[model samples]
Target chain A: MSALLDSVLATAVPLDRALLLAAVLFSIGLAGVTSRRNVLIMLLSVEIMLNAANLALVTFSKVHGDPTGQVFVFFAMTVAAAEVAVGLAIVIAVYRLRRTTDVGEVAALHEIDYGPVRYPQLEGQPVHHHGSSGNGDGDGDAGETGGQPAVASEEAHG
Target chain B: MTEVLFYCFAAVAIASAVIAISRKNAVASALWLVLMFFALAGTYVLLEAWFVAVIQILVYAGAIMVLFLFVIMLVDLKSEELAVMGAPRFRALGLLTSALFLAVAVFVVLNTRETFVAAADTWDRGGALEVESGSAAGIGHYLFHRWVLAFEVTSVLLLSGMLGAVILTKRRLT
Candidate 1:
């Protein structure tokens, strides 16, 4: 047995290869999380990202011939489990309240509105295209009507 | 022999990961993730960490991923259109970042002169890592001896997580 390949065979592969693979996985996870919306899928993407890091850690541990990385992996898994538990609970609550788990709709809540932002009750209330009339007088006219005109227009759509 | 297995499994792992991320259906994505985990376990085997490979299969592929599947089954997510494709800027940014990272990783790997193989030769006979018939013995010794405290802490954390999860889902009395 050739010493280099034989030794590598024993460990399974070169450290460089393992590291590169882990990095690729990590980037895939990163892209998934960045682009995907559905909160559940986002959380899953995060899990994948964490796994990618764990792969790197374990690969390094094997390369160094140490058990420390395994120990760290155990801790990381524990933390990941905890994160999922909390995260899923939040997603469930959000889904229950929102009806539709669409992130685009949720962004509307960030607007400075003067009423209770009851999202659960607002899911199918009709599309509120307040400023989409291509008019620069939105803020000026909105002050006179206290945004009632927007609600009226939406009710007309409904 | 090992190098071939390593490359094969690595390719499988990467391809499956990409499939997992790109699949529009959540369940299909989870299935791809399972394949990716299995391929990763194969890579671990090639690395000679037999026990780690088993744990990778049992814990990650078997247990953790099962939980992910369960959660995916439980949730009812609306099928969102793959709209990020509509944004050219985001796609451009993603490609740029991935390419940059790949370039840096390759540069680092090529620049490193001495590798783990040289160290392994000297460290094999007498070192912190005790080679055994199988990794089970070595891992068992280290886990119980060197990592006893951390193990116990993990147990506590898991317990707390279970309780916390139950509490989060429980109906509150008015």
Candidate 2:
């Protein structure tokens, strides 16, 4: 066993070991993302995946003795930082609208519970809601905010 | 010596990464991830890329982690309260699937030969001359001379990210 250890360390470390580490990190991230129901944790898993890629980039950069790999890593980090900014912003926005960030719950899907019976118009039509031009721009804001527009319009009329 | 250092750092990185992902508390998880990042930076040093190693610690451990902590605090550290009943079984399945993928990935990685071993020879061609390729000065030279356009684009990307975060978090548009 000691002989094997000595032999392994005798040469420059094979790139294989570094690559294997990256694979393990990536799998861990994949598992975390799949199992976690929380949006925040899922984002954390994505960050893990990004870091794993960075590890591989640096490993390869070391192999070629080229600065290009490091440059690629720089670009990747830039993109990752941007992604986190935008993604967290969206998550926060979603959480504001619905108090929870659970993926399984039907917070945003509440409208689907209403079904076709409420609308009843043009279920038989192939286009689905495209023919509802008569509803006009007035209903557009109402549809977006649920009930907020009705109050604003009523205040305007008053 | 480098190889020994490589194994030690790799072990630390993987172990901490496992702990990071498995933790239920976001703060604990973030702390573990910070350790993982440090170990990975150590590995970068083992590769003799001093500039990359420093940047790994500075950008990832310092800047990106602060961003993660900011978002975690903003979210109030809430985990989903989805029912516990079938959750364990689902989580176990996720573990099994990822383990299978890890096995396949490791197998493929080991079987494939390194793409360009010629660079190792290049390192031997001229002793002092070859040293420049992996150094800070070398990277900066190429980054400005060869890849200036991409560098400029990276700045624009960060600028847009700042605008996006501020705009999205704004409470009142009026």
Poorly placed runs, candidate 1 (over 4 Å): A1-12, A107-158, B81-88, B120-129
Estimate the lDDT of model 1: 0.67
Model 2 Cα lDDT, one tens digit per residue, B1-174: 766788898888888877877777777778888898899888776665567778888987898888888877777744435222127888889888889999998888867645534544454464322455656887898899999999998999899999988878766442
Model 1: which residue pairs collide?
Answer: A11-B47, A11-B48, A12-B46, A12-B47
How do the predictions measure up, each by TM-score? 0.74, 0.75
Question: Every model's DockQ, to 2 decimals?
Answer: 0.18, 0.24
- Please tell me which predicted candidate would have the highest lDDT against the true structure: 2
Model 2 chain B worst lDDT run, 10 consecutive residues? B77-86
Q: Comparing to the true complex, what docking class would candidate 1 get?
A: incorrect
| Chain A vs native chain A, TM-score per candidate | 0.61, 0.60
Q: Native-vs-model 2 lDDT?
A: 0.72
